[model samples]
Target: MNTQDRLIESTRELLWERGYIGTSPTAIQRRAKAGQGSMYHHFTGKPDLALAAIRRTAEEMRAKAEAQFSVPGTAVERVTAYLRRERDVLKGCPIGRLTQDPDVMADPVLRAPVDETLAWVRERLTSILAEGRERGELDVAMDPRATAATIFAVLQGGYVLARAADSVEPFDQAITGVLGLLTASTPATRE
Candidate 1:
């Protein structure tokens, strides 16, 4: 990778491993194998590089979600695929973890991507549930917005629960529970 790319990638990994307060310019340079001069030449400073890294991470998260959503399946099935998608459950979510960082949440510039990514996920899921309801795949009484929010909450909460217990069982159980609830909502014929 080029100097700039290396710097951005290194920052990304560092940010994931360490929050903004914990990641330092020296550490980024060391990880990237780039000297101070190269880093400054490629970017204004740490915040600039971190922003690039965070945005890249958010973009990748969106693209990954889109991959699942675009597949041929009913809304619940697509959502199930997304929930069951392989992940490093113990490591927690890259973007969701940022939400816990005081520095990241305190700075609007740093928080924008994290907030936007989460909102985007919720909105996308809402649309999918709405579509399913319209198609009679889900019960007409189901509230798409509410259901979408519930699913999103369960996912993030599951991550927290798993990490707290140092086991993937919590996350698996949460996914299974949510999937069961969703299945219960399906139209009788569809079920």
Candidate 2:
């Protein structure tokens, strides 16, 4: 890869592990094997490089999510497929992780990609929930936006729990529990 490519890749990796505030131009230069001049030649600075990296990661994540959620299946099937999609459970969602970083949130350019990614995910899930409600697969009283946000929160919260416990069991249990709640709420299946 070129100097620019090397720098961007290194930035993404460092950001993944240490976040925006923790990553520095020196660190990225060292990781990329590029000189300070070469690094500066490609990006204005660390923030600029991180912004590019964030956008790239966001696009990758969106594509990955769409692959499963857009597939031919019922709402439960789609949700289950998305929740069960293989992930670095401990690493968590790339954008989601940034939400916790004070620096990332403070910088408008840095936070844009993270916010956009999360908003897109919630909107996509809301559409799915709406379809389910219409088809009677889900209860009519369900508010698609709120329910989607809740589902999104559960996944994000699950990552926090799993990382805190250093075990995947909590994440697995969380997903399974949601699946049960969603399926069990069908009007026909009411107790």
By lDDT, who's the top model here? 1
lDDT of 2 at 107: 93
TM-score of each: 0.97, 0.94
Q: CA lDDT, every prediction? A: 0.94, 0.89
Worst 10 residues of 2 by lDDT: 182-191
lDDT, residue 172, model 2: 92
lDDT of 2 by residue, 112-190 (tens): 9899999999999999989988998888987889888988899999998999999998999998888787888677778
Residue-by-residue lDDT tens digits, candidate 1, 1-191: 89999999999898888889999999999999999999999889988898999999999999999899878999999999899998989888999999998988998999999999999999999999999999989999999999999999999999999999999999999999999999999988455
Model 1 TM-score relative to the real fold: 0.97
In candidate 2, position 66 carries an lDDT of: 96
Q: Which stretches of candidate 2 lie over 4 Å from their true place?
A: none
